[model samples]
Target: MAKYVLTGTYCPDVLEKRAPYREAHLGRLAGLKAAGKVITIGPTRDLTRVFGVYETDSEAEARELIESDPYWQHQIWTSYELFEWIQAF
Candidate 1:
């Protein structure tokens, strides 16, 4: 499997709107982690950005996870980017 990094920038004032959907968003991540698909996931300390490193067979699978996120569906995220990562170390 290859690794991919998914990054997201939260929308302005999203903190207020995220409460209701936070659990579901986290639940999705938890499922991935449990399945060993997620390597690491978390928000930046300032909460402006979030990132997750995932291991999947293809880039499409990684993109699917990001698109399926509740944050993406509800527009809690204002911007997103995905990149294939080669962890040399």
Candidate 2:
């Protein structure tokens, strides 16, 4: 598996807008975490962005995971970039 990093921007007024889908989004991430697909995920303290680490066979899989999330489906996440990480440490 390879490590991938995801950095995403939240939609405007995300704090209020995300309320409806937050639970489903978090539940999905929790399931992925337990399955070892997600390493870590969270939003910035200012709530403007989201960052996450994922372990997957390919970038496509990582992207699929993100796109499938309720947050993305519902527009809580406005946009994102994914990178294949070397994880030097």
Candidate 3:
């Protein structure tokens, strides 16, 4: 597996917009976490962006995971970029 970094931009008024879907979103992530697919994930201090680390066999798998997220499906997350990461430590 390779490490991937995912940085996502939130839609405007994200705090209010994400409410209904938050529970489902977090629940899904929790499942991925338990499965060892997600390393760590959270929003930035300003909540303008969501950042996460994932371990997957390929970038396609990572992209699929992100695209399947409730946040993405609902537009709570407007856009995202995923990159393969080489952890130095």
Candidate 4:
């Protein structure tokens, strides 16, 4: 599997919607973590951006996972981007 970086800007108004979906979102991550898919995940310091590092076989699959996330499904994100990371570390 390859590494990927998922990044996005949250909708300012997503706070209200986020509260309701946070649990479900975390639940999904917990499952991925247990399955050893996610490396790390969290929102930025200012909370404007959210990021996640994942191990996937393809960028297409990673993008699909992110697109299917509750936050994206519920329009909680304002803008987003995903990249296949070529890590030297």
What are the per-residue Cα lDDT tens digits for candidate 2 across 1-89? 99999999999999899999989988989999999999999999999999999999999999999999999999999999999999989
Most lDDT-accurate candidate: 3
Measured by TM-score, how close is model 4 to the native structure? 0.90
lDDT of model 1 at residue 3?
96
What lDDT would candidate 4 get against the real structure?
0.84
Which candidate model has the greater lDDT, 2 or 4? 2
TM-score of 3: 0.97
Q: Which stretches of candidate 4 lie over 4 Å from their true place?
A: none
Hey, what RMSD does candidate 1 come out at? 1.0
Summarize candidate 1's per-residue lDDT along 5-84 as a digit string, tens digits: 98989877778989999999999989999998899988888889988899999999988888888988998877889899
lDDT of 3 at 49: 95
Residue 44 lDDT (model 2): 98
lDDT of 3 by residue, 32-62 (tens): 9999999999999999999999999999999
Q: What is the TM-score of each candidate against the true structure?
A: 0.92, 0.97, 0.97, 0.90
Better of 1 and 2 by lDDT: 2
- lDDT ranking of the models: 3, 2, 1, 4
Clash numbers, per candidate: 0, 0, 0, 0
